[model samples]
Target: MKITVVGAGAIGGFLACKLFAAGHDISVIARGATLHVIREQGLRLHTGNDLVIAPLRATSEPKELGIQDVVIFAVKAPALPAAVDAAKALIGQQTLVIPALNGLPWWYFLKSNSALSGTRLKAVDPDGMIERSVPTDAIIGCVVFPSCRVESPGVVRHMSGSKIVFGEPGGGSSSRISEVADVFLRAGFDAHAHENIREEIWLKLLGNACFNPVSLLVSCATDEMIDDPNLNTLFVEMMSELLELGNRLGISPKIDPLQRIAITRKLGKVKTSMLQDVEGHKHVEIEAILGALISVADLAGAPMARTRTVYALARMRAKTLGLLPE
Candidate 1:
């Protein structure tokens, strides 16, 4: 199937290399030095043991790729709004727009079964720009559980995990979702189709909403942050509030917060995506990870005092670092 990756960083490069090697027609929309490197040498993937280079059509202009069967947007949250026009260029009438992003997405509640459906998370999509630009029918909800990083321009390092879940907003199973999962499976991902991916989204958010910002603020890795008594206590409080808010929002996950935290602590000495952003001086996903949750919590009439505290602190830090508007 014809596919286009909107961003060629980290997750995007990982999937692109695998998919391209698998003989799929892959096109990457990238810019500047990264684009130049990929265009000249192809995208490179180092899966810890194996190094693979994928020959792909790389261009900063989305129109060059034309319509695609699937357009995977792997952009950072803050850059998503500006990415709309490019994303639209590759989206045909029957195309699928899968946003493989962190935290909560703007399309989360677009047409879901949740009571939160139709409610706008302005934190993620200010003024409903995404809603207006991308049609609801074309949106396919995606949640990724992999840990990937860009080692350098055109070089992606896959640390671990490869579970990518896809779900249609209208609920239930669809042949289109199965097809998408098949492509991921072919690319060596543990892919699954979910009737309700929101549950998985919430489960993942439990750790990210807390740990990512905390790590950025303290300039520490996950192990060092969780090792501190004060940090551990704060983490528990944040998870508890998220659980409360998630339940109110109809997100039911079998795993509890403590179990989730235990799983994360096991990873040890890892830097979160947000911390990576801070170190790279790139825009952090504050609104996508925390601001969106706060908006939903308010909609659910759920108390999120602890979560709100973290959000406020993180936003301040982001502004101070020039990661967010003053």
Candidate 2:
């Protein structure tokens, strides 16, 4: 199948490489040094034991690549509007936009059956550009479980996990979702179409809501954030508020709050992507991961004192260090 991967950083580059190796017509949308490197030396993937180097159609301009059968968006949440706008050139009449992003995705409530159905999240979508730029009916919700980091320009290291969870936003198990899943599975990663993906989305958000910001604030790893007595207590309270919000939204989280904390603790000293972004002097994904939850809680009439407090503290800390803007 014809595919284009925008943002070509870590996950994007990794997917592009694997899919390219699997005989898909893959193109990468990258920029600056990364674009130069990929265009010069193709793309390089370091998968622990093996290194796969393959020539790729790397370009800085999305319009240059033309429309594709599928567009896998892997840009950060704060960069969503720009990402969506940039992806427009690749949207054909039948193109599927699969957003492999973190935290609460912008398309979360597009086709929901709740009272909040069709509600657009300002924290995530802001102006509904993503919703408008791409047809909602062509959107395929994707939750990435792989851990990877850009080793350097044109080179990415696969850290852990290979699963990519996907489902229709409206809870429909269509053949299209399965076809997309098959594409990834045939490329060698674990891919599956979920029945009730809302639960899965929340379950993943629970991890990000508790672990990511707290790790950034405390300057600790995942295990440290979960194992530290005082920090772990704070994490539990924040999760409780989130769980309560989930209950109000009619989505039951598969993992209990305490058990979730335990799992994080066992993950052991892994620095969260948010903390890493802070360390790199880059914008962290606070708004999508935490801010969106807080907004949703308010929309659902759920109290979020603990979540607000934690979010405020983290933002303040980041602001003080010039890591975030207000």
Candidate 3:
């Protein structure tokens, strides 16, 4: 299959290398230093002591890549709109578009079984740009569990985790979901086709919506935050509020607040992706991770007071640091 991965960042570069190595025709849409490095050398992935590189077709303009069999969006939420607009030429009628992103996605309500189905999230897609650009039928919801970072331009360092879950947006079985899962499995990932992708997304967001923003505000790693008494208490409160909010939205993730924190505690000193973005002086995903959740809560008339407080502080922090638009 011909696959074009938009945004050659940590996850995108990792996927490109893995898929290319697995005998898929791979191309990447990237810009600046990442594009230069990929064009000169190749997409590189470092796992432990070994390094794997794939010489792939790299371009900043999506038109050069033509329509792909699959287009995987590995960009952060903040950069998604522009990435989608730029990569329009790579998506066709038969193409499958997978957003391998963190936090609540823009298309959360499209084809959903919830009461808010067909509602647009202003936090993630304020102008309906993403909703207008990508076809709903082409979308396959994906939740990535891998922890990776761009060690350098065109290079990704795999830290831990490799589970990826794929499902149709509306839920139920589909051959396309199985096909994508098989593709990832062929590239050595623990991929599964789920019946309810939205539930999986909510399960992941239950942790990310709490930890990612808090990590940015506190400027600490996962284990450190979990070990601190006050911060741990704050996390529990925020997660509890999110749990109630999820219930109102007709999504129930089977884990409690304390159990979820325990899962993160086991990850040991792990730095969240949002914290890493702040440290790198890049734009943080404040909207997708936090704002989107708050928006959904408001839509469902669910109160998320503690989560709102944390979000305000984190948003102000990112804005003051110039990592977010004022």
Candidate maximizing TM-score: 3
- Give the 10-residue window scoring lowest on summed lDDT in candidate 2: 262-271
Q: How far is candidate 3 from the true structure (C-alpha RMSD, Å)?
A: 1.0
Segments of candidate 2 deviating more than 4 angstroms: none
The TM-scores, one per candidate, come to 0.97, 0.95, 0.98
Cα lDDT tens digits, model 1, 1-326, are: 89998899998898888888888999998999999999889899999689998878999999878889988888998888878866788888998989888989887887777677777788888889888888889988888888888889899998878889988876788998898898889878899999888887888898899999888789998889888989988898889888888777777778776788888888767789999899898989988899888888888888788889888998999999999832
lDDT of 2 by residue, 283-302 (tens): 88888888888888878888
Ranking by TM-score: 3, 1, 2
Compared with the true structure, all predictions reach lDDT values of 0.86, 0.84, 0.90
The backbone clash count of each candidate, in order, is: 0, 0, 0
lDDT tens readout by residue for model 3, 88-154: 8998999999999988888888899787999998888899999999998999999988888888899
Best by lDDT: 3
Shift in Å, residue 72, candidate 3: 0.5
The parts of candidate 3 lying over 4 Å away from their true place are: none
Model 2: lDDT of residue 106? 81
